[model samples]
Target chain A: MKKLLLLLAIAAFCMPTWSADTKNLKYVDGTTLTIINKPQHDGNRLRRINTDKYPDLTSRVRHYLNMPTGMALRFRTNSPVIRAKWTTLDTLRHTNMASISEKGLDLYIKQDGKWLWAGFGNPKFEGTKHASTMINDMDTTMKECMLYLPTFMQVNSIEIGVAPDSRIESCGDIKRAPVVAMGSSYTHGSGTSRAGMAWPAQLSRMLGVDIANYGTSGQQKMEQFFADIICDTDADMFIFDCFSNPSPKEIHERFAPFVKKIRSKHPSTPLVFLETVDREWKNFDLKKRKFENDKEQAAREEIAKVIANDPNIYFFEPGLYTGTDHETSVDGTHPGDMGYQRAAINIAEKINATPALKKIIDAAKAKDCCKSPCKCPASKK
Target chain B: MKKLLLLLAIAAFCMPTWSADTKNLKYVDGTTLTIINKPQHDGNRLRRINTDKYPDLTSRVRHYLNMPTGMALRFRTNSPVIRAKWTTLDTLRHTNMASISEKGLDLYIKQDGKWLWAGFGNPKFEGTKHASTMINDMDTTMKECMLYLPTFMQVNSIEIGVAPDSRIESCGDIKRAPVVAMGSSYTHGSGTSRAGMAWPAQLSRMLGVDIANYGTSGQQKMEQFFADIICDTDADMFIFDCFSNPSPKEIHERFAPFVKKIRSKHPSTPLVFLETVDREWKNFDLKKRKFENDKEQAAREEIAKVIANDPNIYFFEPGLYTGTDHETSVDGTHPGDMGYQRAAINIAEKINATPALKKIIDAAKAKDCCKSPCKCPASKK
Candidate 1:
């Protein structure tokens, strides 16, 4: 059995899924999807903004929402492009400099030549009688974008030192919540920034659970990828969706071993295996006579069956939705809300119906017996 | 002097700019910014997508799009993960499944299993059906989001194909037009699925010149990536705004290398560099520190200047709007229309002001120049 497994592993390693090469590329016309993973620092600074501050930017406001103190302020020419190091605070600022009426604004400037920087601070943002030298002048459009509103004059610094009490609470100490989806960029919550649309993100919203997304584009299948995902964070449940790369035989060899390794560590954790379907599959390239589509789908099914023997392993098939039926997917592959709803429904139903969940919920009820989202204390009540 | 130059070169190499390490980590909240190089397909069947029939989508839409086809559309069913596979017409006959469609309607379906995939074909979608599914099967709040008019379908196939004509069109074939932006996700106009909002789409409206978008997401910096952009396609002034990565060093090392490589070969094609920016820096833990913020910006400027010496390498700075400024960024990084419009203005201004551009415009005025969507040649001309 060991030898056979080794052979299978080697077989999986041999077959690589290379995307078909094309001469003419159809660049999908859509918004570039970005992943925002930076933690915001609520620096306690008011003047931290050298650029005009718009109150409506919630993300920005959120960063500074918990600011503990005031910020340090810096000044520059109209643009953030500090042309020459601030030899002296040049009083020459944008015309909107008049808006700095809250305080006086005047400074001297000098450039030996090389670069630009913000030097001495102007205590007053507005002062009438100061004629300052302008460095690289701001252009016309710059005027338009600033909307005639005054820019905050260069840069600002805000100090946000945290108290000893406020820090990343350890998951073990705090009854860790297990609701993170781990996978590739697909799970990273790509597109829907407005609504936060990645499948896992949508799932998080639907389930009302905090989903720690451990997805990175182009990093799927790397051994280190999963090691970090499993070892770095703690979660109650893990929706395993790593089927994008592994070849047919490879999945068979890997799934059993990987799941076994995970089970040893997280013996009781509900590990749900999610198989993905690509929109490109529907694009029709192969000969149907050979049941090429079925061959591929069968391959996926075989992998599912291979893992299905374990009663704890929950397997999902991508049925139930009327495909291509709704204008739900922005790209035929990635679904929009219609797709989101379908995904939520399918996932939640399966989760709710699971015996493992029933056991956990029942056990929790027997102990604390509060409503859902209950705090399951570890006092052995 | 040579030793000094060598010392300077070594100093430049040893002096690193980016200290932010993005190593083994799931995500960093707002700080994660991933920029795709000029990505292209590395496979064959997928290339079928570029056919002229689906001129926009590429010719082999069915194969490239990865949608399902045929009568039965044999989808795998078992442990019940509905992944795609082509079942025979007889299979469809047995199942009574027909075509797939993405149209005006909502979708909601919950599976009793772990996950579900919609069939290749979309079922009849009535607005009420989706609402009913959400209300009954989904959490009330989640259901509310399910209802919306369809924007665009996730694409699958293009109906066009290009039959090759051996005639070689060199850089000399290019007409010096105002400005044409090329390369992957950086250029092919993205941001929204809507046509008007794409940077190129929007810029063409502003510049009164056709600013073509060659950007495709998930792009990689590769020779194959530029193959079609150079030979199969033509542009006047070109802006390569890919500096978001492949790093500055990569840009300096490969960009000119590629240009010189392309130049050593093509010799006369004009190329410009558009620097990529990450607005996630605004929310960085140290953003309140003016010095840190300026360092990142300065690094971008430094890289810009390194190559700025070449007259043809026009540097397009990321407009002053940080990712936060444009709340429209789906991921606090990819610009939204408001962001794109802002970006377009910067590039448009540069292109219009170039003396080389002035020369091209003058030559055009001397000709008949009344062609609609003028088929202006590329630079070598």
Candidate 2:
């Protein structure tokens, strides 16, 4: 009996076995999905921020507050699951910040024409502090997926992993003129659950275009440093949604100057100036109500002064944050997911109908916006 | 001159270093924040689902699906940032899955009596597959915070790290018997940007109590295996919100039996049976409308049959999802943060008002549920 059992065990061992086929697995950079807002940089850092002249790091907040925000990638793959390896330069932990998946990789896949939750990569903290780490084993059977990078951490680089035999591909070239939005935490995705659920991200999904988010938390003060960067950035359109961050005095002093700086660089690019989302509780609180209303009027006058001479500039009408109430905010300052969605749909409609923006979209379509220009569909047609 | 320069650099490094005071930093296990619904296990794994009798791991979804869903902890810390280290057992990868902050440690802190964004621990994926990782340097100045575990991955164990000099304390004791919730994806926190944003988590925060989330995605069938596990769980209340996953036929056939099983174990425990959240599109789509209506009727009927004789069980009133619309969900089935909050507030009010439930809360208040019996505040009071 023992000899027979041994023979059976040997036979089982000799039989061919199936593993994940990892040997055939290949790593793809997934760059085609529009690594939005990230400019080319030397060294290991991938920065959406143009921090060439950022102020000295005074506190830990300074170290973490200026990493990439609203930067993400979309792609398609046949792998049942996706794995990744990357590292962040800063580690800023807060209970709410950490709980919301900030500074970590988040994924959503299109399933049956709707985006579904698949899973997320885990952060293993070991090895050299300066180098990258691996977050493995996300489960999904979908062929296409969108990845939102960490909103608060600067990643050195990222490498997408799949089964050795699986195929990986990026979402191709930026199909439309990218939408560049600069603002405060509202644009930076404060109350939304994940980076992809932010207003700009939702607009990107709705329009099937790339929307680069340059929203910084508590830092969108119409600084010359940011204006200089915007002048140098490449975008078919620009949206300034910083009414919530700066005071009325600062708006009067700096709004026109910033617009002029950008106009000097890209005179014909379409620009959209958004007034602040209304405070729902203003009717009940007289003091707070007056403060917000006063800011709104000042912003309106400043935007009017800046766009009066620029034919390409338009103001996004107020009431975009309709259906909002006290519950729409995380803490009466940041819009929750519901409020974020309202803003996204409103902006998507405004941008979709604007004639100046239409021209940019139409031109990109006519030219086929193809990275491989030799194989341009418009030329072939 | 070169030697002198080196000497100066060394002196600079050695003279009264102003770091976070490493010697004062201490590592504490955050498991005290109500590791609810998890059965005592001898290994490092922290599992909320009844995996002891779980079905075969035929698909990647099944493997990742059965891991922790809403298992989290709450504590107070004076540390500017809270950090953690953990290891996951299986590394399942998918684009949508990897893009989420799943299987990752997330943190939230209380600021001005509201939870605010702090930061998150970065996972380092290197070295042996089964080893610990250190997610360091979360920036904070808050003295109190809450931490949520990964939604998808099975963590072996976790160690919370703080500045060497900072003190770490669990939330003293659960103020009430932890609310143990069992259901489908909604209970699992689908569409929530972070684990703590799930409906149950929201309830926990709202009531200042502990909640153990045992929400399984696509696996909330009322099988005897699961019923057996629930019989053993320790909770102040049991909320069954699995109407979306089971068919009317299953409700008629198995619902009463499952309730009876729990009643057999704890006759007086408060039980709340909830119908599924109304499908937002049902009002507009005929087929979906019928399907949802049928489920609602079946659940109502089943609850009636089970609660006919039992005074402890109560049917959760309809309209828990009253303020919701299609936009409140990621997909039609799962609630986003808005939907989740609406449900949480509604349910919290109902539970707070229920006579049977209030008895449980009152009793708990009278006898403190502190971790260390010697430190029991109720006795002292």
TM-score of each: 0.30, 0.55
lDDT of residue B268 for candidate 1:
49
Each prediction's RMSD over C-alphas, in Å, is 28.6, 14.9
lDDT of 2 by residue, B57-137 (tens): 235334544566666555655454355766666464212222123555545555445554344444443221221222223
> Residue-wise lDDT of candidate 2 within A58-85, one digit each (tens)?
3432443356566655566556446666
- Model 2 chain B lowest lDDT segment of ten: B127-136
lDDT of 1 by residue, A194-227 (tens): 2233455444434433344444432445243254
- How does each model score on lDDT? 0.33, 0.59
Best by lDDT: 2
Best by TM-score: 2
lDDT of 2 at B302: 82
Q: Any idea what lDDT model 1 has?
A: 0.33
Worst 10 residues of 2 chain A by lDDT: A127-136
User: Which stretches of model 2 miss by more than 4 angstroms?
Assistant: A1-197, A200-239, A242-256, A261-336, A342-381, B1-25, B29-45, B49-66, B93-101, B110-117, B124-144, B170-176, B280-290, B319-322, B362-381
Error of 1 at B320 (Å): 32
lDDT of 1 by residue, B8-93 (tens): 46544433222222221121111011101111222222121133323344322222222111001001111111111111111110
